[model samples]
Target chain A: MNKRELFAQIQEKKSFLCVGLDPVMENIPKHLLKYEDPILEFNKQLIDATKDLCVAYKPNTAFYESMGWKGWRTLTETWKYIPENIFTIADAKRGDIGNTSAMYAETFFNREKSEMGFDAVTVAPYMGEDSVGPFLNYKDKWVILLALTSNSGHKDFQVLETGGQKLYETVINTSSGWATADQLMYVVGATRAEEFKQVRKLAPDHFLLVPGVGAQGGSLADVCEYGLNDSCGLLVNSSRGIIYAGKGEDFAERAREEALKLQQEMEQILLSAELI
Target chain B: MNKRELFAQIQEKKSFLCVGLDPVMENIPKHLLKYEDPILEFNKQLIDATKDLCVAYKPNTAFYESMGWKGWRTLTETWKYIPENIFTIADAKRGDIGNTSAMYAETFFNREKSEMGFDAVTVAPYMGEDSVGPFLNYKDKWVILLALTSNSGHKDFQVLETGGQKLYETVINTSSGWATADQLMYVVGATRAEEFKQVRKLAPDHFLLVPGVGAQGGSLADVCEYGLNDSCGLLVNSSRGIIYAGKGEDFAERAREEALKLQQEMEQILLSAELI
Candidate 1:
């Protein structure tokens, strides 16, 4: 989806919430164990509950990959389940050399080849332009490049100064030349709200996929305050916080409640900013 | 496999050559198309033919992922088909937050959970210590961190100076604190032959999984000149150059011939260095 279409969805929904469908088998409700693929069922119910409250659904590929080939089947099915109007992100942190990266692009963007195509893919920018270039080759498919992650290790190399600017800044600045904001977005952690200002300066028009809310102790208010643009360019993801909200058969209902709380807050934020 | 076992295998085989099993469906021989999974068949035959010739097999995960669920199964089966003595690397350049990265670790390293227990996995260092720490937690497993890649985009951020050291150098120096040479390795491309000299100084004992030696325009002799240590601390990878050597019914034999040439050259390199 393009920026205007995504913005229109956020405006109509009055929320920029992106529900994370990261289902762990052990964390799943016991009643789900009766199903052939418990995780897929868990994901479908979660999507059913929260699809209206969120603008996008982000499925981190690591969780599915952990279950082996069966998990991959679950992942593919999960993608098929999410509503097409809701932006879908295959949070597959993949990047490699140009040729290999083209295959990754084909994996996530070309549904004809990979059996699933996502609206956007989370890519690691360590390999630089050529690696990220292949993904941008897909028109309207987004490449959310990693920049200032919310994890504790963010200070390791990302915050280090390269020349006069920090590494993440260099990443944002250098990679901006490779693609316009229409095709590119940045993964800036909600945990580091302070970095959001610096992130905005470099990527003013680009949308930022914010993680680290809820379970990771990131303040949604703080992220919105510094990260939001006129278009409400933020897709704040909350995985463990919402999915594991309940352990009973009413798990989906509980997840909806949790998503409702976030969506309400996002609606308020949009109102206060006069974005809605 | 541990450091000692890997070195011993190189000495026993007299070849530190690592044959890359990155299969593409369009590239496979038409004769193998009769099988249920031609790619898996291609991989099995490649492993069967090169098991004795090369000490390692690095399957770049992108090619498998591009085929969707079937591709993931091919990856699992390919990992299972390789001989126990040969080092296996799921060249999945993956990294994320702590918990997510742990799932990736399970995806590639934990056989009980994922059914594909690879000895080593190529991890991206963009997310820092916590993202990479989980992979090191696995006993006898390896984390070959991306340091200096072989791609043209490697110069984008890797070569930039960060706090008196290049980004890739800082990556090496800081991540070295997370794991020892036994459990940790680095992906230093053979394309940048000069950078190998700098890499060896920081990591004298660590095994470097060197790609870009064949189709990527890297010379084995040049990589060995500056990158080699007493234990022959390098696994030179050649994917397209070796795998697609022939296209007919005798494709496996042609692959063997290509592998044999590299193995013979590696044996000579080992002999001249008196390491065999």
Candidate 2:
């Protein structure tokens, strides 16, 4: 999916919040464990509850992946559960050699496969274009390349100055040519609100998938103030802050409450920005 | 497994090869499709056939992830098929918030739900430390962070000069402090033969996971000459070039042949470096 359509969805729903699907086995309701696939069951209910309040579903691949086959199966089924209007993100930080990356593109975006149909994918920029370009090759597919992340270790390297500019700034400037904003987005951690101003200057038109809000303590207002563009080009993701909001059997309802809170805030932001 | 143990395995086998398990559904023998899971069947035979020939088995997550639930199961089963002596890698370039990353750590390294025991995992360094630190928290678990990539787009950012040093160099120099060489490694794409010398200077102690040596047109001898350290710290990976050497019924046999060829070359490099 391209940024234009994503914006339309946000306008239609009056929300910009992207619910993150980062299900933890133990964190899931005890009742789910009785089912053959607890992860899948939990994910289905979560999607059912919050799909209408959000414009996107960001499934952090590591969560399902850690479960091995069962987790992976859960992720696939979860992808199917998301509504058609809501964009799907395969939060798999995949970036590899060219041919290998091409297959990754096929795995996530190819319609022929039984796998989930993700509108966009989170890509690691470290491997450069060969790892990312293959994902971009698919028509209308979006690649959310990593730039300045919100993590504490982000200071370890992402903020390091190289030839005057920070490493992430260089990544943004250099990778702009691989694909257009229509097909390429970036993962700019929400906690790095200060850097978004600089990041916007680098890729003024591209979308930014911002994590680290809610549970991680990143300010939503600060992110909107600095990160949003004219098209509402930002997907703010909250995983633990959303999915694990309540540990009880009413987990989905609690999830909806958390999602509603974000959506309500996003609705106001979209209104002020005149995006809706 | 820790670096020392992984090295010991390499010494015992006299090979520095890390065979990539990137099984494509279409690439495997057609007969395997008749089974409940073609990808799993192919991976099982591949692991069984090549277990003794190499010291590490790196399963690129995208290949199995694309298969949806069935694909995930195949990855789990494949992980099970690999012997304990042979190090296994969940080649999933994962990085996210601290809480999310911690769960990812559990997913890949948690032995409690033991169907698969991967010794290490490939992580994207773009998110900085919080995204990477969780992976390192586990004792004996190794995080192979991306350093210099082999893709054409790699030139877009990884090689960009930042404060006189390239972006990738900064990632290596900065991330090295977060974890010891025993816990951290770097991905130096084999295709970037010219940059290995510089990468070695920055990360002399950390092992390098080198991809693009075969089908991607990278020179194995070139990377070995410049990238090899005193510890023979190189896990040269050949995915498509080795795994899909032939598409016929004897694909597994052909895969063994291709792997053997690379193993033979790696053995010579190890011997010449006096690592054994």
Candidate 3:
């Protein structure tokens, strides 16, 4: 989806929330196991319950890949189930050499070939421009490059000073020149709320797919305080906090309740900021 | 395989050559299309012909993932076809959060789960220690971390000065503390021959998986000059230069011929160093 359309959806839904579909069999409701594919069924109901509450769905590929071929099937089916208007992101964190990266782009962006056409795919920036170039080839699709991650390990290399700027800052500055805000986004973790202000200065207009909220203990108000832009260019993601809210037969409904809380908070924030 | 076993295999084969099985369907011989799975057949033949010459086989995951579920199947079958004595690397270059990275380790290391157990899986080090710790949980399995890549884009962030050391150097120094050399390795590209000496200073004992030889214009002699240690700690990979050496029915034979040339050169280097 284009930036304008995404912002429109956020305003219409009164939320810029992006639900994370990182399902683990052990975490889903017990009653759903009777289905042929419990994960797929769980995802379908979750989407059914919370489709109107969020503007995007991000699926981390590791959760699916760990289950082998069956897991891949589940991922493909889940992609098919999500509503098209909601932006879909393959949070795979994939990057390689130029030619090899082209294949990865085809895997996620070529719907006819892979049967899973995500509107965007998260990419690791370790391999540099060529590794990220292929994903940008799909004109309308987005490449959410890893900048400052939420994990504790983010301190290992991301914060190191490089050429007077921190490593993540160099990543933002160098990568910003590679593509326009419409085609490129950055994965800036919500854990570092203070860094969001610094990041906004570097990438004032680009959308930041903010993870590490809810289950990871990142505050939504602090994130929005510094993260919001004129276009509402922030996709705050909540995975386990929303999806695994309840383990009963009404798990989907319970998930909607959790999503509603976030949506309501986000609506108030948007109103106060006069973004909607 | 453990470090000792890998070195023994190198001595047994009299070569440290690693044949990269990065096959592209469009590049394979036309006659192979008659098979039920041309890519699998091509890989089997390539392994059959070059198995004796090279001590390791690294099938880059991108080449297969681009094909979707069918491609993943081909990768599993191809992994099953390789000789057990020879080292196998799923050159996946994957890493994420601690819990998420564990799934990736299982995806490549746990044969019971993923149906493909490789000796080593290349990992990107951007996420820090937690991202790499899970991969080290499996006994005897290796995590070949990306230290310094060969691509032109390597200069983007890898070589930037950070805390008086380059980003790649910091990665090697910090990661070396996480795991012993016996279980850890680094990807030191052959293209940067001058950097090998510096890399050796930081990681003298850790094995370096060197890519970018023939097709990428890296000289084998230059890489071995400062790269070889007492254990001959290097796995020089040549993909397109060897796999697509010829496009006819004799493709396997031509591939073997190319592999043999590198193996012969490697054998001479090993003999001259008196490490065999």
Candidate 4:
């Protein structure tokens, strides 16, 4: 999806929320195990319950990959199930050299080859431009480059003072040249709310896929205050808080309740910010 | 494999050559298309031909993942086919948060879970300590961190001066504290030959998985000159230069011939250093 189409979806849905489909078998409801593929069933219900409340669905590939080929098949099926109007992101932090990265691009963006074409794929920026360039080759696809991550390890190297600027700043600054905001987005963790202000200055027009709102203790208000742009350029992702909200037979309804709450809050924010 | 076992393999084979199995279906010999799974056949033949010459096999996951579930199955089968004595590396440059990284660790390290138990998996260092910590939880499994890459984009952010040290240097120094050299390795591209001296200062004992040796224009002699240590702590990888040596029915033989040439060079280097 292009920036305009994504912004349109956010405006139409009244929420910039991106529900994370990181379903672990151990965490899914016990009753759902009766299904042939419990994870796929869980994911389908979650998508069904929350599709109207969110503008995108971000699936962290590790959750599926850990389960082997069966899990990969589930991931492909889940991607196919997501509504076309709502954006999809393969939160697979992949990056390599030019040619190798091209294969990764084909994996996430070429539907004919990979059986699933996500609108965007989160990429690690450590490998630099060439590693990120191949993803940008696909005309409408997005490359959500990791900038300021939410993990405690974020301080280990990202915050280091590099050439009078922090490493994350250098990443945002240097990587801006690789692609425009239309095709590029940054993964700026919501846990680092204060850094959002600094990041907004560097990437005034680019979208930021913000993870760490509920389960990770990041405040939605704080993220919106600093991270939001005229186009509502922030995709706040909530995984455990919504999908695993309840484990009963009414799990999907409970997930909708959780998503509805976030959507309501996002609606208020969007209204106040005049983004809708 | 453990550090001692890896070094023993290197000494026994008299080579530290690592053959990169990055097979593109379009690039493989036309005759191989007769096989039920041509990519798997190609990988098997490549592994068979170079198994004796090289001590390690590094398959960049993108090459297989691009083909979807079938490709993933090929990767699993290929992993099962490799000789147990030789070290296997899932050159999947993966890293995420603590919990997410645990899933990634399971995907590559836990054979029971992912069906592909690799001795080492290359990880991107941008996410910090927690992102890399989970992989170290597995016994005898290695986390080969990306320190300095071979691509032209490496100059973008990796070389940025951070607190008087380059970003890659900071990655090596900070991450060295996360795990012991026995479990941790760094990827120092052969293209940056001069940087080998600087890298060695920070990580003298840690093995460096050096790519860009041949196809990327990195000289093997230059890499070995400043990069090699007492245990010959280097795994020089060659993908296109060796695997795609010939496109005809005799491709496997040609690949062996190419691998033999590199093995011969590595053997001479080991002999001259008196490390064999």
Positional deviation of residue A231's Cα in model 3 after best superposition, in angstroms: 0.3
Question: How does each model score on TM-score?
Answer: 0.99, 0.91, 0.99, 0.99
DockQ of candidate 4 compared with the true complex: 0.89
Judged by DockQ cut-offs, the docking class of candidate 4 is high
lDDT of 4 by residue, A23-66 (tens): 99999999999999999999999999999999999999999999
What does DockQ come to for candidate 3?
A: 0.79
The best-first sequence of candidates by lDDT reads 4, 3, 1, 2
**lDDT for every model?**
0.93, 0.82, 0.93, 0.94
DockQ of each: 0.93, 0.62, 0.79, 0.89
* Tens digit of per-residue lDDT, candidate 3, span A70-134: 78888889999998899999999899889889999988999887888999999999999999999
lDDT tens digits by residue: candidate 1, A161-193: 888999999999999999999999999999899
Label model 1 with its docking quality class.
high
Question: Per-residue lDDT tens digits of candidate 4, residues B177-262?
Answer: 99999999999999999999999999999999999988999999999889999989999999999999999999999999999999
lDDT of 1 by residue, B1-276 (tens): 999999999999999989898889999999999999999999988888888999999999999999999899989989998888889999999999999999999999999999999999999999999999999998999999999999999989999998778989988999889999999999999989988999999999889999998888899999999988987899999999889999988888999999999999999999999997
Q: Give the clash count for each candidate.
A: 0, 12, 0, 0
Model 1 residue A260 CA deviation in Å: 0.6
For model 4, name the residue pairs that clash: none
